[model samples]
Target: MPDAQLRPEPFIQQTAPAALEDLRARLRATRWPDTPEDAGWSLGTDLDYLRELVTYWAEDFDWPAQEARLARLPRFRVPLGGLGIHFVHARATAPTTPALPLVLSHGWPDSFWRYSKVVPLLTDPGAHGGDPADAFDVVVPDMPGYGYSDRPAGPPLDSVAVAGLWAELMTVLGYERFGAAGGDVGSHVSRYLGLDHPDRVVAVHRTDGGLPVFTGDPADLTQEERSWIDGAAAWGAVEGAYAAIHRTKPQTAAFGLTDSPAGLAAWIVEKLRSWSDSDGDIERSFTKDEILTNITLYWLTGTIGSSMRMYRANAAIPPAQHARRVEVPSGFSLFPGEPVLPPRAWLERTTNMVRLTEPARGGHFAAFEEPEAYAQELRDFFRPYRTGTAAD
Candidate 1:
């Protein structure tokens, strides 16, 4: 049981008008940078698009309306592990059937906002044209140093630490056993939950396992596994610099990003465009408003630096920790646009693989990009495990 003193307090999303005005001033006064002609996102965030985005952010983007929308969700903050962790805890709405408690963790470059679109669908499946039995009492927490969660004053918290925090959080909410699912860094945390707390996490689901970490002889790996390993390395060589920076010198990068909203947007939006199933058209996957809403959250919270520090802490995790395979039943949905797909052989080696899926759409931020399909995948994968009520 959780400590009775550690009760959750209701939280509301409210930013002062002065802060919003200050953001507009900064956006309007952005010092534009030069980009080679015809570079068109190949070099980085497209200059033209960024300029247009900054203009919209300065003049048209409505923060109050978005804040109101976010506040409509059941949000709370609880003092756990000496930090006031913020989360959205919505009960399942099915009338007769009891809902399963499922915790959804979000990765970097996003917060709980990543799962906002799909929360309703999961918490009330019947309302979204799915079975009520599939309902989940959804809990989406902002990882330490992300979104509204408090930043660690000491060393940053890694996946393992965050998983422990999550376990305690579930206990505080009175959920003894539950399911876990996430993508990106969240996937790493979810894996740890299944590993470190296997007795409690019923099953684990993830989009991609963290970068391949094989220590055995190459001869033992299948051809597909070798290719997958090589592919991951190749992708990292070309596109993983952001992560490298996060792991090494996030503070140096943080100064500029913290002061300049445009710089922050360029740093994050580039990944959003490159990692999504947008086909060179980012707006296809996310509207300008949607993009700004996420970026604005980072700016308001002033958490970009602390969030990146998670990489630094995770980089210090020993090789033996990476080698440990999860014992809990696991599911993977390799979305089509995900940069490097973990082959079944690798997932089998790393997890107790029970399900593998190739969804027709989406990319890195699938939950936000294709909420309907993403929600349906969860509904189908966890259906068999939904054996008890939310209060059981």
Candidate 2:
């Protein structure tokens, strides 16, 4: 049992009626922007698609239904490391054997919503066509400044700081040792978890090995590794402007994104389309409601700024820290749709990589884009490390 001081309080999703109305009004009154004739997604978010999505957002999208769906998850808030952390904690369902404790961290442009689909599949595998013995007691936390979690009042918390908070959070949740898995920003957090708390983190799983940061001799890298590094640099040049803005001047970008629903949707929807396996059509992977739900969470929470500030905080992380290798057992799943895929040599150089897999589909948001496949990856990677029951 958790200590009284650390006991979690049940969280309910309830947005004021007026807030929802105001969002609709804002969406309906968006000032349209002009683009060159036949301009697709080459420049930025497709204007035609934004207009259509905003129109639906203003008139047809249903928030109450979405709220109800979110409410079905086991949500809670608990104070840890001077911040109120919101997370979903679901216990394994009728495990035929001991269940392992796993923590799923989310990344940028998303929150706990990123892992919503995979939660059930992991916690109740038997019901989802998997063995009950593979069930896991899953915990998905919204990093500070994202979702319902309170933003840091002072300097933005970087990945290492967030990892410490997660360590404490797991302790509060009665998990002394657990599996860690994440992608994007969450991947950074999990890497730190393995690096900083190897004794507690049974294993770490990540989608990518993080942006290649080799301070050693370039000759030390394999040919494949060098090629991957070059590809990542090239990819960053084209698709990394948003990150640059987030790192250098989040406040300037935040004003418009926080103020305009259409702008926020454009900012996030573009990534959802380009980063996922949708093949230029985002709707193929996520419904409008799904897209809106994620963006709306950012809008309602008014967290776009604080969330972006994390980039600035992370930028200050010393190169020495980046050069430090994670010794804990780790696994990588390179989803085909992800733009930058780290090679096996790069991963092995940086981590004690026990497994490396290239899944047939999915992208940056694999958990949300391919929940069953994502869940299966976790189950397979962590199976060997599941030494005891959830209670252990």
Candidate 3:
């Protein structure tokens, strides 16, 4: 779709009762895995916790209720770059007038489910107890193969190419210039949006910053930045095994995840528990039902494998292209619990960072876990660039 014409259509989310029953059946039939009593998440996902979650998911968790709530968002699909792009376009109806447009990108193991909580807060800040002037028209897209979006038959699109697709999507939605924000893979996408389409992207915001963008002598970097780089590498050495698997053998892992709902839950819930600011109590970050709903989206859609394949595609990109820097204004929010928290100096020097904040709480899924902070950070960061009719 070099020059794809936009055809936006309303989307309705429905998981067939048969599918729901099938998921329950799968949960019920899960082949148990044995683990040592004291291992308790040190090796991987705790077998006991996963069993507890599976029990709840099979008998108690309600898919229809969760689906109905998610359906309340105004979702739509528009063809862009030879793919069907699904997104929640819950624009701000603030009476202040021209609410700024914001395009949010989601990362792995999750979809638009990530930013659903932040949508209401950003699109209606006044209703959430913030000034109406801070309102924004929120747009959260399911990256190809992640949510209800179409899966690529060939290779999946990488961050740079996906950034191009997003630029086109925003244009189709009539946003000549807008803000871009994301975390995880989304952080990479938002950076590319600022780097590749600076004229169209007013500013960019990210919760995490990764990708080898720096060049020249490492000795020039400050002690904190150098330590951060080394720390990030060490963290990756321990935490990046999943990434390595995704890059090397997503198809092999996808088989079980695609067939067994318990398999899917075990694979994703571990990350949710480990990456959050919850301090090991998973419920502190997300309710049991909330966790199930996220996994259910992947289960019902059968997208776990496709989503994992994106890492393989991303790895194919040349390091030279991945090293491109941003010319547009960039913002960073260093959430306390994210696995690798890059220092402010590293962030600014890496990208054209303007606003940087160390929020007291939240983690990798900050938008879902702490929507208020996420929304407020976005409002504060993009305020300078939102030049239009102010709220009266």
Candidate 4:
């Protein structure tokens, strides 16, 4: 049977009254922590702040309403190569001359909701004063085992395997060739899309500067590169506690994360604080409700364990994963606040290095944090290959 005719499994929105009850109970039963007079983020999440937030999460937050809002979005589970992948495909209402197809992938600790603000911007660019011809039919898939998607059932799903599934999904939707964009784990998948299926991928763009591969000469490093390295080293010292756990003992880490909502919240929230341009507090950029919504998705789906397992799978790959050079046309918008934004020389080693822009501001969640700038950067990058002229 043709792939398109192969019907996608409908995402049956599951609402467990018991799960909601459990969340309320957990919040009510939270063992309170005492705060130190001088302690701040240097000591991690503030206890007083936690007391207030957990109180709200239990007393004031409306899980049913938020779940209903999410359920309103179009969702599906398509069978691809013996795997059932779930995705949210929100189509643009306004017509585009050619109807450019674009796949926006999200990374770890983020669901399809990461691009919640971004989907409309790209699909309806005219609203943002962008060319109608540049409008896209956006496909935002939850990485397998991350959100509404299924867990890695039979075999371990790595980056390359997921890319193949993505190509299949796009093909099913009649997009012969399309543009791709992503960051974090998604950035790796986007790069693999360009490398593994260059014929179908017109151009690859990533928010993360580049992958962390030791390709450049350490001896010939500029002052900036040295600082970059120093910054990275410092982060590993202070903020990389999660990475170490995810890499070595993911199952152990998952136990605590999966059990306690507060534990999950603190673990993920710490990364958002350290990795984002939030200035100091997570609430400065993301509301407590917004933060918990993402966390709730993980907890409800029981994916905290499976998601961490991805790091272990990546680590098991041979160290020579970057020995091969990529030949696809690529663009990058490097955000300074991301975990490891790469230098131009480093990016050139992995991608064809077509276009590179250092954004004045933004973070790992670029599309959500700065939509206008991110949308403008995307329009500028993909303008060259758009099929229809503005006159058309």
Candidate 5:
């Protein structure tokens, strides 16, 4: 048990039957879009394939079994500024090595489930044929309004506030300092942790390698910068419609996504397939149960609205505010297939980059998509800083 000053665990049992029933009802009432021959994925999600996935999700998928599997992990909740934040605190059973306290933050559309596979790899590295000295006392939190955590009543769930709450959570768990890492929105939040609370975070790592907000300054860019800009522009042309919608009218978009399970699944699954290292097909890497479990967490907790609001809220902040430089030691594990991949020079301005590695595989969801390599990157990067840190 943690300190009594911290709020006791607030456990919410998942409703598998309710999730299945919701899927069935939504699929039965879905409105289909007409498509001509050879339309393919060029037209966003293929209607035929989506319908097939919806059918399996409603009829054949085993939600209860998945829920039972999740229940095996030790879960808890703690009060942070009047909101209950849910997290999984899994400790390694290893007796020979010291376990470093590390926090893993999940990005938009991905729940803490993203860390499930990587947790054992990190918390019990010896079991996976890795150095026991690299093991971590893993703490994976569901960002406010994302999982079992209830919605915040006051300010929106911005990156800085989320990082502050994480600091407090670690303190509550008795760690005076810790290491943090994330990808996508998680990457930004982890950067903020290093920037805003460097005294508490030993080191920080990100998979996206801090994306710069473009300002059309061609003269300021190097050859690599220009290439990255070109790639980002092309990606925005094909796949950034979701960003525009989320930034402009999250409330309007939330109504349909929050009300219909199918709508929510399509919106999220598109990102998972497009941004993950699954070779463009989600089913190739993750089971249908895995996909639905993530989406269901959003729908069941009524956080679709709040989650989208992060986009709108972030947009409201000034570009200069978002572009503030991070002074803490930061590492980047640039995955091969993320939306906006930044070159080292571009990222160096935004972060105090200490180490940068370009992985041959993985995408935005590196922890889940490439657990072994992702865990190894984390292990090697933080291993040197593990001693003399408050996290120990």
Candidate 6:
């Protein structure tokens, strides 16, 4: 049977009253942990802040309202390669012409919520003070085992395997060719899209340099490259222990997160706060509702374990496959506050570097933090590649 005939069905948000009540019960009965007065966030998530947030979550935060808002978007699920993939398919609005198709891949601790703010901006740039010609039909999918998608039931699926699924997903969506972009784990998935589907991918855009894509003779390394390697080592030593746990003992860690909502929040919220460009106040980047909405998705869906297991699967991919050069036309918009901001030379060394821009602000969750800028980056990068354009 043809892939499209898999019959993608409309998906709606309708959490049971029982589930919401149970969540509140858990939050209310949270086993609070004591903290040192001076520890602050030095040891981990601030207990003082978590107490306030949890209070608000149980007493005032609105999941039904958020769910209603999210339900307004066009969302659907389709059976692809035995996995049910949920996605938002937002078409270009009030388009001056037909918009180009674009697929956005996202990483852990987030589902399709990563691009929630940027969707309207990309789909209707005119409403946001941009040209209508810049609009794009955006497809933001919840990767297998994340959000409403089904957990993988067989052998592990790595980035390359996921890319193959994505290529098929685009085909199933009736797109013969499209542009691609992503960051974090999604950036690696996007890399494989360009690497394996150059014939169908119009162009590739990324926020980070998609590390681990570099491996060669030591003699070929430049001083800047050496510095980047050393800096990455330093960053990992301090900030990458969570990933180590995910890679080495995700099942052990998942036990706590899966059973306790508070535990889940601490594990996920720490990253949301630490990796963002919030300075010291994460609220500056994400409101309490925004943070809880993402956390609630994981808590309600029970996918934290599956999400972390992705790291272990990816770790097994051979270096040769990891380091393959991307030949598709590529562009990048490096954010200053993101985990690793690569030099232009480093980007050029990794892919078929075509366009590169360093935005003055934003971080890993740039789309969520700075929607307009992120939307503009996509518009500018994919402008020349759009099929209806004179250049094309």
Question: Per-prediction RMSD in angstroms?
Answer: 1.0, 1.0, 2.4, 3.0, 2.3, 2.1
Which tens-of-lDDT digit does each residue in 181-291 have in candidate 4? Answer: 898888878888888888878888899854355555778666666677677778678777777787789889888888888888777877777778788777876787777
TM-score of 4: 0.91
Pairs with backbone N, CA or C atoms under 3 Å apart (clashes), candidate 6: none
Q: Assess the local accuracy of residue 21 in candidate 1 as a C-alpha lDDT between 0 and 100.
A: 93
Steric clashes per prediction:
0, 0, 0, 0, 0, 0
lDDT of each: 0.93, 0.92, 0.87, 0.77, 0.80, 0.87
CA lDDT, candidate 1, residue 303: 98
Kindly list the per-residue Cα lDDT of model 3 for residues 1-392, writing each as its tens digit. Answer: 22345678999988778988888887898899888879999998999899999999989998899999999999999888788999999878653757888999999889999998888889888898887887898889999999999999898889888999898888777787888999999998998899888888888999998743456688889899888888878888888888999999999999988988888998999999999999999999999999998999999889999999999988898877755677798889989998888877777677787888999999999999999998999988988888742222
Put down candidate 6 lDDT per residue, 362-384, tens digits, no spaces: 88988888989999999999988
Q: Between prediction 1 and prediction 3, which has the larger TM-score?
A: 1
- Cα lDDT over the full model 1: 0.93
> What is the alpha-carbon RMSD of candidate 3 to the true structure?
2.4
- Cα lDDT over the full model 3: 0.87
Better of 4 and 6 by TM-score: 6
Off by over 4 Å in 2: 1-3
- Candidate scoring better on lDDT of 2 and 4: 2
Tell me the TM-score of each prediction against the true structure.
0.98, 0.98, 0.96, 0.91, 0.93, 0.97
In model 5, which runs have C-alpha deviations exceeding 4 angstroms?
A: 1-4, 10-12, 16-19, 214-218, 390-392
